[model samples]
Target chain A: MTGAEGKPAPGKEGAAVSGETETAATEVVAGAGAGAEADARVGVEAGAGAGGQAVAGAGAATGVRDRTAADTGAPDELWARLKAYEGRAATVACAGKDPVNAPMIRHWCEAMGDTNPAYEGPDAVAPPTMLQAWTMGGLSGHEGRTDAYDDLLTLLDEAGCTSVVATDCEQEYLRALRPGDEVVFDAVIESVSERKTTRLGTGYFVTTRMDVRVGADLAGTHRFRILKYAPAARRKPRPGRPRPVVNRDNTGFWEGVARHRLLIQRCTGCGTLRHPWLPGCNECGGLDWDTVEASGEGTVHSYVVMHHPPFPAFDPPYAVGLIELTEGVRMVSNVVGVPYDKVRIGLPVRLEFRRYEGAGTGEDPLVLPVFRATEGGA
Target chain B: MAVTADRPVTAAGAELPPLEIPITRTLIVSGAIASRDYQDVHHDAELARRKGSPDIFMNILTTNGLVGRYITDHFGPRAVLRRVAIRLGAPNYPGDTMVLRGTVEQVDGDTATVRVVGANAIGRHVTGTVTVTVPAGGA
Candidate 1:
């Protein structure tokens, strides 16, 4: 029976006690510390740790606390209190805002530039990476979130660890989430790491495990981790432009850039040309390929001026264009020598090699290919 | 459209035709909205700058969607996706381009597993493995 204080009655036994009761009982024992051994013994006897137990048996009895005590600023005590929150519910049976449906799927595919036919038509299922998307509360946020996670964060904030960054997340899909399947999930504070020093600062890593479900069957699990840290002095280093990703298939292209040459892949079998490089030609499925130096004369097939989210290496309000080369291949590059607003489709442009000074970060100077609008073409 | 009758014969070392996606502000914002993720960092540039990002970046779901697209685009319409597991690295900002490349790693009966990596100007945006079932038997 739920007692007046919401804690399970001390002597209750058997499967009748709900998960909420077990969680409440575990919290009480963890807060009361070693003095609650008798209660923990009873908890073990009553099948309390089955679904929602925070810490089992002797584990809960060791981290006793004086809830009314003032801050001691001791790292061990803070860590102990943080560890006590492990296995607590972050959100319980939270319902998705929208069920798996087609309209949203279409929108997602469109934005991602994806035209895979499997995502359309009648049998379409939500994208698997959409595991977390379905759980997001959107503008208003869901009401199913519990206070424990927030309380943990507040405790860290009070301890001078205020800044937060999401490090990474991993997901495993058990089944495809189809339209009309009502998504429901429960999240648990899986663990909290001890204080550690990182490049950003000293902080603790908190990871949460969420099990998403449809009806009573488990569908997938998502584990997310974030680092809560104290702020360090801001470094004034000017960040360099993001480096291009180069791998085996396209290393030749980058090598071309280093030599101030723009190279396009040409199929050895069919003579078809391709841009951005590929291992096999799409037209011939030929594995052997050779490179051809581009003439660099092209017209802007399309363009977009980026004004937001400024980067240190380049000025904003510049035009990035899809240049369709005379050789019949298109590639994306910055369009220069013209105002961002003046750049237009079908504008004639010529390629130029631009050298960028490194940010004194021990990186070599980078030479990249950009397109400049022809005189009077703008 | 008749199920193609014949599917491409898949092998372990087969490579998928690469896809190039121009990262644009429209793609970033629409991807966020479509996924129902209303986080400020995904849609609002000023707020994102205040929070330390240079601009709004692509959400993980969008990255996932692109990866899924890369696989199915190669395996054709009848391809059924079973699993997608990915980890994020570099953020995908507008004015950049992300090129997705995939290789068929294993094929067992109708199910084939592919390794996918999406790289942009900054670095590798996403790396993961996807398992899908493609229709059996073709050239």
Candidate 2:
């Protein structure tokens, strides 16, 4: 979703357009150092808002829309034209930074804290999910990307799909990637979904399919999807607290909250226990499950101090703990009864069911499980 | 979109099961980003506060998605959501829980009308009516 707006403000890169599809992007980017922008910071100002007004502010900043409307019939038409690139190979990213190697594999495994012995020896195969890792172009930027890619972004940007995020990625490994295998790949713009509205806002779903090869052998295909859209309006807060989102998978867990009990899901198939209840057992694939009441005793496996977003419902820099219960399952909840800075990993703690009144916003008393330090010193 | 007379309609006063989902930073950021919303108010706490919000708030898109999920889940995959009218009432900031519950309001032919309320500790986050056309067997 990086577009002309991403390049600078339109004030910096104005002389670009779209009557012809191919050189239109090149000529536009070639127009890059326009240099007459005494008021170029308008783009920055517009981005700072990032809400409904921001796009309009950005549009007002450059008046790029008037020209866009005139040139391509409309921005939507420009988006439709991008579908032509579908089913075509993108410019090759690179021969890949290096051949698949054990050192990098070791590093990745270590970073993920994986300890499988099968990964350490000469017989080791890189993790199947590491398929995309071998093909990354990294921070220096991918070498083989063409202007077509940037044009798609600029077109989307001009249409005000300024924000972008990778929604999810799906990868299938056809075979094991071993050491000294030179990895090469080409990606295709497989499909662009029609404008669809979601919980985020309205935008297109762009799926890129990457085919990975090792010495002409098809290794894997990685499919990644990103959503590009204009942010929707924020909801107006009512007097009461916001409600919890519950579905079939986790309804029983909330019922436990209502009853002042912390329940963990136990797999009847394998007698394995887990938290944040799942409908099926991750270990045994068992759909039949039961509940186990938590002993309320655990230790801080890890913790985070949240400070950036301050809400009337919570104090800033509060510590949220990932508590590993005595029953051997971990859940995240607020860490109470200690200074935010003092909460530590492995600190023994006790869980308490507590209610937070969301500042008289008319939200009902909210009940949750939080941890309290039993005895601790850093 | 089709419904069968033999398929039992959800009783008018019956409550759809309540769902309890924990709201976290990952959920808030991913949901917003996935919905193509780059509004800083949904992700950046500091920027949101500067923009006069108490904190980064959930966007309407996520709310809409959840509501859609609420109906589809009840009637199963074969059900088609035709119309959903929702009004937002509260902010679903990170760390809060959102409990969604619904009741059947009316049913005519293949279409059944349902009303849903998504409430958090602070209060109702969303209240709306959803019209879903279920399969003849209530799929």
Q: Candidate 2 at residue A208, lDDT?
A: 58
Candidate 2 lDDT by residue in tens digits, A1-378: 111111211222111111001121211111010011111001111111112211111221110111111122234454467565455444453466768888876765543333444345877766544555665544343555546656666666666565443333444456668888887776655655545433333444455556677866877765544544443444444334345798999999999998988999999999999877788889989899999999999999999999988665565889988999999999988888888999999999998988766535555688888899988535
Instruction: Estimate, for each residue in A1-378, the C-alpha lDDT of model 1 and write its tens digit.
Output: 001111111331111111110121111110000111111110101111111111212211111111222223444667789877776666777788888888877777778666665566787777776777777776666666567766786777666566554433456678788888888877777667666543334445566667788887778777655545553334556777778899999999999999989999999999999988999999989999999999989999998989988888778988889999999999999998888899999999999999877777898777889999996555
> At residue B58, what lDDT does model 1 achieve?
73
Provide fnat values for all models in the order shown: 0.28, 0.00
Worst 10 residues of 2 chain A by lDDT: A26-35
Error of 1 at A349 (Å): 56
DockQ of each: 0.12, 0.02
Q: Score candidate 1 by DockQ.
A: 0.12
Model 1 segments more than 4 A misplaced: A1-79, A196-201, A230-232, A237-378, B1-9, B135-139
